[model samples]
Target: MNPETAKPATAAEHFFDRELSWLEFNDRVLQEALDARTPLVERLKFVAIFSSNLDEFFMVRISGLIERERAGAAGSAPAGMAPSQQLDAIRTHLARQTALQHRLFDGELRELMKQHGILLLDYAALDEPQRGALEAHFSGQVFPVLTPLSVDAGHPFPQMSNLSLNLAVIVEDPVNGLRKFARIKVPDTLPRFVALPQGPDQAGWTGVPLEQLIAGNLARLFPGMIVRGHHMFRITRDADFTVREDEAEDLMLAIEEEVGKRHLDGFVCRLEIERSMPAELRESLMEELEVSSRDVYEFDGLLNLRDLFYFLSLPLPELKDMPWTPVVPAPFQAAPDESGEPRATLFDAIKRGDVLVHHPYHSFAATVQEFITQAAHDPQVLAIKLTLYRTSGDSPIVRALIAAAAARKQVVALIELKARFDEENNIAWANRLEDAGAHVVYGVVGLKTHTKIALVVRKEEEALRRYVHVGTGNYNPKTANLYTDLGLLSCRDDLVADVGDLFNYLTGYSRQDAYRKLLVAPLTLRRRMYELITREMEHARSGAGGHIVAKMNALVDPEMIRHLYEASRAGVRIELVVRGICCLRPGVPGLSENIRVISVVGRYLEHSRIFRFKNGGADEYYIGSADWMTRNLDHRVEAVTPVEDAAAVHHLEQVLAFLLNDNRHAWDLQSDGRYLQRQPAEGEPERAAQALLMEGARLGEF
Candidate 1:
């Protein structure tokens, strides 16, 4: 057992290892799989999510350890432990979790399948009738796609691609009668779950793994040979891409080409051949993958059950979550003109003053999409400038940009192609944007342009007015319908001026020195936030009302953490709604007792960053793209804008207060790292924050 996993008998390390912290988060996700309250289908989705998360960890984190070991840079993690120490810790934790996963998943899946009347057949479980049917289907469909390669003097081992599941088969020739190793790649083009032919189970619901069917038909695949043994396994390789800027003549093209090759990365992790398999076959697989025993995990039943995600769409309504769609906010639902229209035209609302939107609760399609789509074709709109980090693979936002460019409107785009996993999508979008005559710029060299800002230049009779849309999340409509984020559409002079300068910085050669209404990072975000919090502390010391309320994804930056502690000591009541990794030790004697930290993990991913400070008699409110983490505050180019509209500010506080009061889906953080799940105090129903708000948004229509 990992030291981190064990409950300390005494006062031990106050902090958990960062890697262990991540694993704890993963465990929380796995907990959702076993959560009886969750919809049955959603629970299965969580299992798939857990598998996907672990796969990425092996590709990035585990792969990094291997790279460090190869380069003799083993003492990499800052905790002072050697690189080997970290790797050993990782292996121990993974082994424990893997065992737990099998225990939880196999049992739950079996019970769920029984309840749903859907069975997944295994090779031996199938009768002669089923075998005959599978054979006919295999010959017609699966055989054409099958490619078998034998390991002899003729074949040097082929390069194994990342995330490919394959079989290690042992076959003996009838004539020569010498056993040889053969490899059969699982055809990804074919569906992982194969439906049976001419059965009630097939017509309604029931399936078998393609691997099981292939295993049963192994003799047919290898004619004039006897299949002694075969085992199913998978290899997860290092998919992290590294490209040298100096080598690329065109950075965009080079990045796209490199991204295409990322699938064929170095093998780093392996899910093992079954323990029931022959020792020689297992040994052969380990040799081929170049993995140690620690790197290989063995499961009792299935190899890649993550494919169960496909079964989630099995047309079992009772087994799935109640269908829910995003709600349009009350303000927008009310007729804008008091006459008739689909709410208000977004531009007119911004022209009226500022409009703030909270997504999933507020319809993203109505608010943000309308903002851009309106501007794209509006005759009064002169130019549009937007910063895109990551959008969905297919986005209406990109279509709006193209339309804006087609209208001969000057469209400037700052496309950040280095957005980790979304690099390829961004690269493709950039090329399309460039070809459309839109002024497209790859973001800053050192810092990622993470600021979600949109500038619209429009003619308003007397002069050209700049209306800016600043947000705490991406412009991706899909995420907007799932993530709790804030978007402010405003035409304030100071904010519009700052946005104009930002556009100049991104699209032109101008260097912006200072922003009047916004605090931007990689330049001025930290100092500005520090000054705001310090002012609140000063007011609290002077016997003025002082309070600090912030909502963010994580709170891990040391400098900011110390500042928060100082504020807590100065009699400033701080409420933090952090959804993930928090290193700050709250509720400590003489340290941070006034500081209250709670995390809300529910259906929607809490992604927005909001900061509210009570400055003497006046209140200061801000919404931005940056979190309190170091990477967001100091390293990335981010934006924080003031919520100047009185109505908008009122609305922001309305929701923030509700989230703070939330007990259900909220976990209170202790002085140590443990997150104590908040249960209902009395026999009252749970106050699930997201669900309550969603109901509010739904009922707000009244």
Candidate 2:
């Protein structure tokens, strides 16, 4: 057999389906809920997380596939699955996972909650006094907000908003001997779980499903009609959209219009109905909603388990994991002098050397937020430039920017209004910044600015020095407490200059294509990454022991995966810690024998992106905002900075080591595209990476 005449492997032979891989990640989330070792309330939280994740997946990924299938798009996914095929596979996989989810919630979690004195009751379970109390409460509160739309000849079928829970009611008119169908949307403003008044013997918290309460009181909603029955249902719509920046005159207005359309005009992608819903009513719903049978899901238990989040708010500390408070890094803590006075500000600490902060372990407010706040108030600061992709509702960072503008400091904010599901929030922040006299630009055309960067220029003596903050997550302090992220505060000359140039490119008419120490996407990032991988391949061929370790939220670029596979064939050892949506098929016999992939899903979302390459023993480390996805590397404006500071690089190395050594909360990806959770063997001490990090942060070891 001639080697040159042999055929090459297709992409389908080398990669896993992207959508299925994402579902597997969510399955890991459901696994957390099934794991009895986890605290009871924490397991409930995981169930809610899983539900929310599936909602978004349908709204975006599944919706896109539906559209492609309708249009008969010819392009297939990298895994060689067409849109229709992927849809079929997704439905099959999702049905099994959702069945498991229902079993865990109904058969296990609910029973366990009862044992712990927590009650999630139905309307039928409420006692006489409790029912009387709820009737009065409903009449006063829920009745006024309820609007039941009757589906008759006069009124066409009412449009259901995205993810709204509703009751399909059948009421008979006794006087006319006629029946009518109506829809009642369960108010989102009201709590999904209505608390029940405790009896003398009841010891713990008790609540009833809001929908059940509505179902029990349908006669109140229809005074003169004979109420038949009501069944619960939910619908998910296509919430994904694209703004044509070239055609739009105003980017912000365009984004706002798209967001408005998202709520009212998205096509229904999924329909969820209870098993009790009659076949006739179900078919009517399918017809009116214009959803096919393939998209319909029947559940034996609750419709939307995302409402399980309500349980987390109960003051049952015994059934929850111990709360963690992010600590201020040692450098950021103002050390006292002999006179008991503070030494210096956050800027002063950065001047000495680079300061590295890891969130959910290190405090975001003490580090990144403080950096912006002090820059806003500092008189010597000449200008502040930052990129706003996503932030909190009551963002202190935005307030500081407004304060800087009020103080007559030069402020330039590159607000990205096209951030998915965050367009409205970003627009509100952009308008506030513009009204405050800060120059707010909607990033460069044809690209969503996904970079996390901030530059502060200050005047010291006769010279102007620049300070920069580069991170892997958004600037939202709220999410900073729930996500594992990394940020670097530096005043180094070359890195700061690069960040300043990147800001110029974002806010002005600069076609800057290169950076000295930073990797800017869509220009140098992809090329540089390929070069790095190729260099490792060369090193491996030369017997120099090539090695690479990368941590990110996803790894979906086919070219990048191919490069990694080539390096693996060259004897380079590659390890990937991707938190979600990894398409690479690792640990194959010949294709990727030297590569391994693992995903970590736990208490905190692993949101940081770190890349390490052992360049013939002279290692190179980077921490930045770009993943290996094509959208990140080729379509979005992203930034990745080298951790040149020895201390910062060492910290990143330690983080990678912790992630790789983790036995708990980590799942190894097999060549067959299955994820097996890693568990400690007998006599092996438990090593949970996140717990270890928390301990280290408390001891100030990081």
Candidate 3:
């Protein structure tokens, strides 16, 4: 284990390929759709999630690998995988997973939907009446949007936008008997699934794929030509682009320009065509798109299952998961005062004790939103400062900040304009905030401000007091109902001071490198994490019994993985609940036998980052906006705070314990990089961590 003796090739054995690990995570998402126990409509949601996830994977990860390959980049991955090698691995893995997804939808889900009186009928399967209705609808609604671009000597090839689904059509001119090729982009503005009128036999809804409707009515567009054949196709472009923040005069303008260019300028990373597509057409597509065979994926059933999300709007409550509303935490819930009025505000509640709110389980509207809304209107509040990584389009948090700014309260918003795919939205938000008189900063020059922390300075009695809310997710209310996240509200002196200092470092040129209580990334997080792991190792070596449990979205940093391995070798029991992209190999005899890794993929996305160290029986817990990824630790600005409140610490401990014991949704990772979904033993009760958490939330457990 000597660092001097270690070779890069040997070190590769201890980790899995980052790209392949991600594909495996997507495969786990596919597994959710494949699981029969999941509700019918919920399964469709998972299929959509899987498709959406793969789209991003191609746009960002696959595109990056292709770029590296084109530049002839050497093996720079910690797993010692060359760019070309990773690309090949992704192609092979993704093809298999995508095929499985298609089969599940086409073979099983469609049939299941039919039984539930919901029909996803093809054009050929439609009855005369249904066809007549669709024809009328298509002529009136869809024909106006259709623009068929021809590929001829005079026309040249059309530029396909990223993730645009289209129909590759072949037509013959009867006069000359010449075959012509044209592409009709399916309008994204229209619904992908065209709903059919309810029939006598079908109690629920019936819908046809929009592409099928377009394909069936091709002759309407080509009046004189004979429609030979038509096949569906989709293209995924390289959406990953970097804005040179250091060189640009205005970071927002640079990002806006980059965002505009990304759609039209990026190279084709993947081409998805229907399996029935002719060889000549496929070859022509490959040639015109400048994509190799490795980049092409042929699908049998559907081009984009992401459109399955459309069916979720159907009013079939029995076919979906039981909806649960998030409850307001007891601390935030209003109580009757002596005069029969509502009791103290959120500020007063936080001042009483640290309040931890878990999203989706804890009402975001009643907690985080209420906090900001109150701050905006609070007469005593002096200033509001926060960082925006990603938020919803109609974000209440942004509006509150704008309100605070309008009220003449000093408002500083560090909006990250480079949050990948969200650049345009973030840019729009930045502009809106700026126009509303809020001071908007585009974050650090070379680093992204990813910390999800907010500071509100208010005059309490006489002195000014700083209250902070640090979280593991964005302040997006829409996602708050979807993603499981944690946020801590406190007026703790040391924590508030650290957050103030962090904001100063972000908004102004404060060369701050240290903090009292919080772990700020790129300066203290990496070093402190290593020290924590080493301390656990020391504890285990001294026979004090060491244990560490951490949960995050991903675990990708090599040094962090190595530290975990070292801790495992030192006899520290390391349990990691990484939801995606785990590079570290666990349970190796000598290297990491003491390490156990599990991933939980279920109803809600596991997004919160929780780190717990036994600390020789004196448990130390932390929750923050960081994963073990290098980007999170050394590249982005992050903050991790100690959960000093005994109640919050206990709640986190319970969460970790539930995840570890979860049988229904947990997937255990083996040393050989394979994951096996856990199941309850005979006579054992079914245990799903998310479901349990929801029940606990309803019962006011935390």
TM-score to native of every candidate shown: 0.92, 0.98, 0.98
lDDT of 2 by residue, 73-128 (tens): 86565788889889999999998999999999999999999999898888987889
Q: What is the C-alpha lDDT of each candidate?
A: 0.79, 0.91, 0.91
User: Candidate 3, clashing residue pairs?
Assistant: none
User: Which 10 consecutive positions of candidate 3 have the poorest summed lDDT?
Assistant: 1-10
Cα misplacement distance, residue 629 of candidate 2 (Å): 0.6
Q: In candidate 1, how many Å is residue 441 off?
A: 1.1
User: Which residue pairs collide in model 1, if any?
Assistant: 74-83
- How many pairs of residues collide in each model? 1, 0, 0
Candidate 3 deviant stretches above 4 angstroms: 1-10, 199-202, 338-340
Q: Looking at candidate 1, what is the lDDT of residue 50?
A: 79
| lDDT (10s digit) by residue, model 3, range 1-702 | 642233332478888988889988988998999999999999999999999999998889889988889999998768999999888888878888888899899899999999998888889998898899999999999999999999999999998899999999999999999999999999999999899876577579888989899999999999999999998899999998887777898888888888898887899999999999989999999998999999999999888889889988989999999998999998878787899988789998999999999999999999999999999999999999999999999999999999999999999999998898898899899889999999998777889889999999999889999999999999999999999999999999999999999999998899999899999999999999999999998999899988999999999998888888777777899999999999999887778878899999999999999999999999999999999999999999999999989889878988998999999999999999999999999999999999999999999988
Error of 2 at 356 (Å): 1.0
Which 10 consecutive positions of candidate 1 have the poorest summed lDDT?
Answer: 3-12
How do these models rank on TM-score, best leading? Answer: 2, 3, 1
State candidate 1's TM-score: 0.92
